[model samples]
Target: MTDSTPSLDLLLAGYVLNTLSQEEAALLEQYLAADPTLQERIDQLQATLEAAYATPEVKPPPQLRMAILAATEALPSQQTEALPSQQTEALPSQQTEALPSQQEAEPASWARRLPAWQLAFGLAAAIAIAWLGIDNYRLRLAKETAPTEIATETPASESLDYALQPVEADLTAAAQIELNPAELEGELTVAGLPPLPPEQVYVLWTILAPDAPFTADSKGAILTETFNTNAQGNVTESLVLPEAYQTLAQVAAIGITVESADAPQAHQGSPILLTDL
Candidate 1:
């Protein structure tokens, strides 16, 4: 291959790491498409990369360097010491002649005779570099593909506040109801109302509009809650409105009536305090 063209292994590594330039990636794709079997190698590399990433790094023991060095330093002397005995065992003329020829045939480069530890360290360093490359490449790809969230201010819920009007203009009783349509909840605040006896209680009612959906009550009034006033004839109660309360369009009005505490849903009495929606 020309100097400009990367070897197959280099191209595969670059492709797996996603570090290939446009032209290099195109070249690799062409080769991969031509040989469909190359996909298996790609998958293997991907799996290996994932495994390496999932593996936790472990530090070498402190004595590892000393052990490796000691072994390497002792190798030459141990080999030299064995040479005389080896020569004696090969005393036959033919065998001795073959030993010298074998030694001569071996590579003369010092790199070929490098200590095992040095070769292993070089390989470990290369793998570490490859892992780092893959990790960084994956992080960059994630950042590029990740969806960005836009900050938005949510509009506040629509709150409906109504004042309860006493049935008799001379009555000093006052009350108010605040409803949150979004949450389908409301609060009832009342003061100066006359306290009822044990047999009677104040029943809140929701009067449905004429076009409201079918309800259990034929009178179009939903019995909301039954509450008792304090000794001081004042009460503040948090009320959970029904789903129908979400839209006032379905409600004709809100009212409070003095009903029999045993059966508040009977709604036998007229509204003592009422508010038209």
Candidate 2:
């Protein structure tokens, strides 16, 4: 709605905050009486405001209320005389006759008639309070309904299989790999290998059955994981496969490659030990 149009939202907000002029409050009450949607919105706002204040509330010190009351009493009174009461139609100085009073009188024109400064101050105060309440409500909600982090536990290995034996022409190594299908983890232990420079490491490669969304080289190869051997020329590692590569059952072959430390993720070196499933 345009700013010029009277807003049901403004009326609803003021009603919830108890700051509406009597006329606006009455109008809002009448609107809500007939509109369930509007009533729901107002109720939701009121519930949020209540939830924000309900918890983490501490009572003020015993004397705080009394002191505040005393201070307010001591202050000079501003003329509570309402703004020029709504214009009254002039009747004959002496009415020819009296009419019976009706059940309700038209409400006096409110806030619209207040001085400019009073209107501005009231608006500023209301905005500040509303912003504060909204911020607090959000913080409380975040604290109570935060996402929980789930932890994956390692599964027990069913068996350790010496799957691949390196050829003597390249380097002597014994490869025993433990498979934990439940956790999608593999523990690879390579012994009898000679460790030389710090800039080199062993890379494990696997050939998956060519039916997945995985990127492979011309030789249909995918890097499983990489590990650096310890100073004793031996390496043991528990490798974890990402969700996409967890299709271990679909792997056709497992192999090991000697890759330089600076080698790109795409494997170019040939396998030192390779064996088909």
Candidate 3:
């Protein structure tokens, strides 16, 4: 209906096949009125089909002809022998009544007569399958309604709080650190601090005691995280602490300082905020 060339071609194919519905025929006629070249294409298609049909027919091989003939000859005898019982079933009511005793003497071959052992085995198998199905359904139902026990972990032990005192008295910027000794994890909350430029970030440092059984940088500090404060100059961050924090004596102190974002671990700056572990 939209006059698309492919759609018109499809309608033309259906027309050639004599398969187009009445509505499709009318639609194609509308297109044909607007496009006279479509008629030439139709004539070319019909001529090609006629040329193909004009090709002389070739006979099948003699052996194939013989095979088909042999199959046809044997079909009637097979049907007659296989369905003798069907003939009796089609008998008139008068004939059936007259030959009642004869019919009883010659039971229909189509009705299978299973042996006693076979019948018993089949019945036992059916019972077993039914029992298994019922048992499976009950098991599934029980699982659906059964209460489930979830293993809940004990809450993390209480954390120790340490206040980070600002070195510059005039600056009211301060922070608090909460360390979970057992879990070796902590949170740092900073307030009243000013945001740094993109190239600079705030870094947290954990300094260890001289004789502690843990590694540290040249300045005896273990760098934790490098972060930037938001426009409000406030940020809360979770950090993983060193194992030495479990024994407060092993950790000397924790601190925060401004550092180059490119190399925060270099520890080039001194602490502006410090907290004794």
lDDT of each: 0.71, 0.61, 0.71
lDDT of 3 at 195: 98
Instruction: Kindly give the stretch of ten consecutive residues in candidate 1 with the minimal lDDT sum.
Output: 147-156
Query: After superposing candidate 3, which stretches have Cα over 4 Å from the reference?
Result: 1-157
> How do the residues 105-171 of candidate 2 rate in per-residue lDDT, one tens digit apiece?
3232344445555545545444444555666778878776653311223212243354786755666
Q: In candidate 3, which residue pairs clash?
A: none
Position 200, candidate 1: lDDT = 93
Model 1, 57-82: lDDT tens digits are 74445555565555566656644553
Residue runs of model 1 more than 4 Å from their true location after superposition: 1-156
Tens-place lDDT digits, model 3, residues 1-277: 4445545665675576565666567766877898878888788756645544553443435654565455556555554565546777899988877764532332222112333343343334333444444555676887876643211232234578989998878878989999897798989999988999999999999999999988889999999878888999999999898788777888889889999999999999989899886
Top candidate, metric TM-score: 1
Model 2 regions lying over 4 Å from their true place: 1-162, 168-170, 242-249
Least well predicted 10-residue stretch by lDDT in candidate 3: 103-112
Order the candidates by lDDT, highest first — what do you get? Answer: 1, 3, 2
TM-scores for every predicted model:
0.44, 0.39, 0.43
TM-score of 1: 0.44
- Evaluated against the true structure, the overall lDDT of model 2 is 0.61
